[model samples]
Target: MTENKIIIKLDKDKKKELEKRFSQIGLSMNDYINLALNQFLIQGKVPFEIKSPSYDISTLKTKKAMLKTEEEDIGIIKNSISNSDN
Candidate 1:
């Protein structure tokens, strides 16, 4: 079943252009607007491509802490191996 609905207060030129585009895609005005709105609400972003840049942290203290953890693990493993040989 289909129901009739009315939309008020849209700019005439914009609505006409939208209708033309919608017709090209084989969709009615309501369908085209609803599809666009549903996608926008669900995604919360535009459907266009974007580029992001990367960053690096060059902190010596952080690197030293990581190395210290690795050294401690290696020492534990070596001790465990030596004790198992008894």
Candidate 2:
């Protein structure tokens, strides 16, 4: 079989976090991808769910979009809702 290469771009914070988690579990990002690919080939389907992010409505952007607050800046931790719910 012919080989191929795939490139992926990740956010800096997410890359750091994933690296930490993978290290704790004795795995690299490439190892994880290979395992996932093998699982897909064995099962003939994707093994994980693709879900939207949960949104923080307390953030300034959300409030601004809703036009429900006087605050003009993103605030600290407050609350969150499922992206699917909105």
Name the best candidate (by lDDT). Answer: 2
lDDT of each: 0.71, 0.75
Q: How many backbone clashes does candidate 2 have?
A: 0
What's the C-alpha lDDT at position 23 in model 1?
Answer: 92
Error at 17, model 2, angstroms: 0.5
lDDT of 2 by residue, 12-85 (tens): 99999998999999999888998999999999989897654455445656756555323323444333543475
Model 2 residue runs over 4 Å out of place are 1-3, 51-86
Q: TM-score for candidate 2, please give it.
A: 0.53
lDDT of 1 by residue, 13-53 (tens): 99899889989999989886678677878999754555443
Per-model TM-score, in order, reads: 0.38, 0.53
List where candidate 1 sits over 4 angstroms from the true fold. 1-8, 46-86
